[model samples]
Target: MQPKKKIYIALKFIIPAIIFLISIGFVSKKQEEKLCKKIVITIENQQGNFFINEGDIMDKVTKNGREMVVNLPFDNVKLKDIEQRIEALKFVQSAQVYRDLQGNMLIDAVQARPIARVFNPVGKDYYISDRGEILPVSERFTARVMVLSGSFFRPYLEKNLLIDQAGKDLFNFIQFIEKDKFWSAQFAQLEVNKSGMINIYPQVTKQIIEFGSVADYSEKLSKLKIFYDKILPDRGWNRYERVNLQFKDQIICE
Candidate 1:
């Protein structure tokens, strides 16, 4: 091939590649500036009693989110700070604030899912979610959250009411039950006694099944399955006054 012809072909490819890169850069820049053009805050569990307010945006989104806006430009707005503020909200479970491809800022918020009501020894009770989240028990009790009474309640992180490890474990267990369609509406209350024994009270049956501690939780749950399928409905769940699954090998019923 001729040198001039080869050079022309190279230029053709190189020009297009550069133009494409420039276009992408421009698009990205616009996204950063256009983020949050119209802020939309949707509360999934805010009504009657939950303390979710416009002021909750502070710890819920970070810094002063009320004053923040979209299409204003990314240089002026701090993304990390805004995220922190939104997360600070008590009812907010998770938050993600980012600039979309078109340079539009979208603040995505996920509110915590409340599983039960926790009564504390400190004379305080709060709404407990399957994700190990807690909402203060204020004057409002109109929401349909179930109640949980136990010897153990979650300890919070410094000044922040985020639940601790034990609370998180309890939350995971509740999530497991709710995820299963068979047991979703069966449970009414989950109680932890003074001896750290875990008990479940089903709404349909007045009897309480004593589950011992969090250790071997899966094992105890498996035993319950057998009892439910093989024993309960066939023999009548009322056959046992107190169902104990604390032992390693067997379930002893009273």
Candidate 2:
């Protein structure tokens, strides 16, 4: 083949490749410029009952300042950093920050579901999430979940989550009551005494349920259910001021 003909053929391929690369670079630059326009925050509170709002997430994103990431360059907005900031919120269970194809910064977040609220004698309040995580109460919103009070020590309150065995037991108990249709509405509060004995306060009946310990809670609660469904209706709700289910196999009514 002639050298001139070889050079012409090489140019045909090289020129298109250069044009393609340049076009790709231009399109990418335009897309990035579009992404730097505005940020869109979307809060996915699936149940609509969770405490976190879009503003709560935005507060973390901006740190209550405009220059942080809002209306800033797309490359400057770190999705991982935003996610970490949102997840740091006590109520937030998980968060995801990303950029869509439309060059818009999108933030999706989920709030932790609180199963119960714990009120200590020292006036400190904490929320026990469904996953057994202990979170501080929100200042903006108060969750009307089950309230637990009495004798929780400092060690239990110091951590952001339940680490001790006793705390875990209490967490499990509250979670169980919250999940159960009959118990969730029936029980109003849970009290843990210094002796680690658990006491349940009912919503409807004045009778106090003495649940001694957390072990065998299912069996103990089942016995109590029998008393409420079978015995209480016939005997009258107020007939027994206290119902004890601490024993091995007995529902002692007094």
Candidate 3:
């Protein structure tokens, strides 16, 4: 090709590239100058409760008792700060704040789901989230979940419960029960002894279930189900005061 033809071809590509960069910068500048006309907050609660609301999030997205998102330019809105403030709430699992092309500030937050309510011996009652996070009890709403108590839970107050082996077993046990429709409805409360042995209190039956350690819990629960399905039907519900499922493949009733 001739030198003049090659130069024309290069200019054709470079000129459009420069114009594209300028167009992007101009659009970004316009977006920054745009004022936020509305604020939209969305809370994801598929597995969560009404522990946090729109008003609660709005309280965090403010400066000196005044709303900071609406009526402010996009450049002035501190989206990161707003997200951090909302996520600081006890029930909030995560938060995301961003501005759209329509000059609207949007905030999306996910709330933690409580799987069990723990009534510790120290008198500090709190809820355990599905992910094993310790959440403060909300006065605004009460969740109907499995109740866990006893002296064995004291260590969780000072240290991270989810990290410990015993805590992981306990969490898994609770998940197992929660997933089972019959077991979840039958058992209401659980008490753990110093040796980590769990005692279950049934909602319909008066007999106490001696569920020894979290080890082989699935097998023990399976045996307990057999007792309920076969033995309890023939021997009456109140025939035994205690049902021991500690021994492997055995249901000791008294």
* lDDT (C-alpha) at residue 138 in model 2: 72
Best by TM-score: 3
**Residue pairs clashing, model 3:** none
Q: What lDDT score goes with residue 117 in model 2?
A: 84
Determine the C-alpha RMSD for candidate 1 after optimal superposition of all C-alphas: 9.7
| lDDT against the true structure, each candidate | 0.68, 0.81, 0.87
Task: Give the alpha carbon lDDT tens digit for every residue of 191-211 in model 3.
Answer: 997778999999998999999
lDDT tens digits, residue span 162-221, model 1: 345555566677677767767666777788764456888888776688987877888998
| Candidate with the larger lDDT of 1 and 3 | 3
Candidate 2: C-alpha lDDT = 0.81
Output the number of the lDDT-best candidate. 3
Residue 241 in candidate 3, Cα distance off native in Å: 0.6
Q: After superposition, how far is residue 45 of candidate 1 from its true place, in Å?
A: 10
Error of 2 at 193 (Å): 1.7
